[model samples]
Target: MADVNPFYLGAFAVYLLIVLGIGVWGYTKTSDVMDFWAFGQEMGPWLATWSFVANFVSAVSVIGFIGAVYGEGYTLMTHTIFGLMLGTSGLYFAVDRVRNLDLLTFPDIIASVTGYEVARPIAGAVLLGNGWLYLVMQLVGASLLVTAITGVPYEYMVWVIGIVFIVYTVLGGLVSVAWTDFLQGTVMVGAVLLALGYMIFDFGGFTAINQQFAALDSAYVHPTGEGAYTAIGIIATIVAFFGTIFTEQNNIVRIAATRDVRTAKLHLAASGVILSIFYSALVILGGATTVALTTSGLAVDNVDSAFPVLITDYVPTGVGIIIILAVMSAILSTTDTRLHSTGITTARDIYSYFRPDSSDDSQLRVSRIATIAFGITATAAAVNPPGTIIELYNFRAVLLTSAFLIPVYLGLYWAGLSARAILASIVTGATLGVGTEIAGGLFGVPSTFIGVGAATLVLIVGHFLLSDTEPKGGTMAGD
Candidate 1:
C-alpha cells in the first residue's frame, strides 16, 4: 500500500464534516415521524431521482461489481446491468399504484395489501435481515477503500464510517439521507467518468485497451471468463436483481417519498438511465485495471481490492482522491438509506404493530434507537464479513426478492390473496431462499429461482385452497 497522503486525509475530513452538516440541516427540516421516514412526501423529481440513483448504486456496484468484472470479465456486467435496467423499467408499472398507497415502509405496503397484521412483522423481519446484510456489504467495501488509501486498520475504519452515518441517520432520517444521496450521486457519476476517461487516455483508446487486456489473457476478454459463470448463474442473477428492485425498501421508500406518481416515475426513469451509463463506464474501467496492473507488474491478493489498488497506486493522486470520495459517497449514500429503512421497519412495522396505539412521537423515538442498534451490529459484522461483497449482496437480494416479490406485487393488483396465503408465501420463500443459498443453489439452479418459484407456487396454491373457505384480509388500504 502507498504511504498515507496527508492531502487525502484532509479532504476526507472535510467531506465527513460536510455530511454531518447536511444531517444537522435535515434535522432542522424534520418536524415529525413523517418527515423522518418519508421526507414528508415533499420530494420533487430531481432530489428523488438522484436519491434513488445513489441508494441503488452502492458500494456493491461501484466496488464489488467492478471487482467482479476485473476478475470474471464482462459476463457479470451483462447479467447485472440487464437485470437492473429491466427491473427499473418494471417500476414504471407499479409507481402510480405504489405512490398512491401513501405508505411509509415496505412492510406497511405488505400489511396494507394483505390486511394481515401478522404479515407486517414477518415482512419487517425479512427487511431487517436484508438491510443488515446489505449494510455490511457497503461497510466492507468502504472500509477496504479507506484502509487501502489512508492505511487505517480496516476494523477501526468500519466503526468510524458506521458511527458517522448512524449518527446522521438517527438525527435526520430520510431528509438527511435524500439530500446526501443527491450529492453523493453527483460525485459518483463524476468519479466514474473521471476514472473511465483516465483509463481510456492512458491505454491509447477503447479498442487499444481491450486489445491490451486480451493480450494478457484471452479469458480477461472472454464472455464467461474462466468458466466460473454458468448459463444458469447468469439467468438467476438477472431474475434476482430484477425481483429485488420491487422489494428493496430503500428504492420503494424513495418512490413513496416523491411528491407525486409522475415525479416517482420520473425518478425511476432518470435513475435507470444514469445507472446504465455509470455501470457501463465501470465495466470499461475494470478491463482497464486488468491491463494497467499486468503492464505495471503489480498483483493484488484479493480481487476485491483491485479497484482501490488501481486508483491509489496507478492513477494520479488528485484523481485518486476524487474516486476515493466517490467510494465514500457510495458507501454513505447506501448505508444511510439501509439504516433508515431498517429503523422504520422496526418502529413503524414491528414495534407499532405490537403497540398499535403508540403515538407518532413514541414510534419516532424507537426508530432512532433501532437505527443506532442496527448500525452498531452491522458495523461489527463488517469487521469480519461472512463472504465476498458480491456473494453477500446476492444472498440479500435473493432472500428479499423471494420473500416479498410475490406477496407484495401480486397483492397490489389482485384481491383474492388471503392472509394465510401471504403468510405462507413469506415463510416458504424465506426458508427456501436461505436453504438454497446455503446449499449453493441446489444443483446449479439459483436460489432465486427456487425460492421465488416456490413462493409463487405456494401463494397460488394456498390462495386456491384457502381463499374460498377462509376470510380474505380485506382489500388494500388505498382500494
Candidate 2:
C-alpha cells in the first residue's frame, strides 16, 4: 500500500463530522416511528429531490460506472443511464398515487392494497433481501475507492464507513438520511462537474478525449463496446432499471415522505433531470479517464479503480480531495438510505406482522436495532464481495424488480388482485429471478425478463383461479 495522504484523511474526517452533526440534529426532530421511517411525511421538494438522486445514483455511478465505461465503452450508458431515465419516467405516474397511500413502508402499501396482513411480511422479506445486496454493493464500491486513494486496506475502510453510517442512520433514521443525503448530493454534483471540467481542460476538448479513447481501442467508440453485453442483455438491464420505481423501497419511502402529491411529482421530475445531467458528465469523465491512463501508460487492477486512480494519481491534490469526498458522499448517501429502509422493513413490515399490537416505541427500537445488525453484516460481506459493484447492483435490481414490480404497482391500481395472487407473484418472481441469476440466465434470456414474465403470469392466473374464494374489497388507491 502507498503512504496515506494527510490531506485526504483530514478531508474525510471533516466530512464525517459534518454528517454526524446532521444526524444528531435529525435525532432531535425524530420522536416516533413515522419520523424515523418517513420523516413524519413532512419533506419538501428540494430535500426529497436530492435525497432521491443521492440514494439512487450511489457509488456505483461514481466508481463502478466510470470503471465500466473505461473498460466496456459506451454500451454501459444504455444499460445504466438510459435505463435510469426510463425508470424515473415511470415514477412520474407513480409518485402521486404512492404518496396518496399515506403509508410508512412499501410493504405497508402492499398489505393495504391487497387487504391481506400476511402480504406485509412476504413483501418485507424480499425488501430485506434486496436491500442487503444493495447495501453490500455500496460498501464494496466505497471501500474500493477508499483503498485506491487512501492506501487503506479494503476491509478496514469497509468497517469504518459502515460503522459511521450505521450509527447516524440508527440515531435519526430517514430524518438523518434525508438531510445528509441533501448535503452529499450537493457535494457529489459539484465534485463531478469540477472533475469533468478539469478532465476536459487536460484533454483540450470533449472531441479530443473521444479521439484519444478511440485511438486506444476503436471498439471503445462503438455503442455496444467490447464487453459481453449483448442487445438482449442491454434491454434486460434497461427493463430492470425502469422497474426500480415500482420496487425500490428507498425511492418509495422518499415519495411517501414528501408533503403532498405535487411535491412528490416535483421531486421525481427534478431528480430525474439532475441524474440525467450527472450521468452524462460521468460518461464523459469515463472517456477522459481512458485517454489519461492510456497516455500515461498506467493500468488499473480493475475497471472500478479507473476513477479513483485518475483522481488520485493524475489530477491535482485539491480537486482529487473534492472528488474523493464526492465518492464518499455517494456511498454514504445510498448506504444510509438502504440501511434505514431495511430497518423499516424489519420493524414495520416483518416484526409488526408477527406482533400486530406492538407499540410505536417498540417498533422504533426494533428499527434501530435492525439497522445496526444489517450494517455489521453488510460490512463483513463488503470485505469479500461476491462480484463487481455493477454486477451486484444488477442482480439486486433484477430480483427486486421481478418480485415487487407487478405486485406493488398492480396492487395499488387494480382492486381485483387477490392477496394470495400477490404473495404468489412475489415468491415466484424472486425464486425464478435468483435461480436464473445463479444459472447465468435461462438459455440466453436475462433473468429480469424471465422472472418478471413468470411473476406476471402467476399473478394473473392465480388471481383468476382464486378470485371467487377470496373476498375483494381492498382499499386500492385507484379503486
Model 1 RMSD in angstroms = 2.1
Q: What would the TM-scores of all predictions be?
A: 0.96, 0.96
Tens-digit lDDT track for model 1 on 269-334? 888889888888888888898788768877787778988888778999988988888888888899
Give the CA lDDT, 0 to 100, for residue 427 in model 2.
92
Q: Candidate 2: how large is its RMSD?
A: 2.3
The TM-score between candidate 1 and the true structure equals 0.96
Displacement of residue 243 (Cα, Å) in model 2 is: 0.9
Clash number for model 2?
A: 0
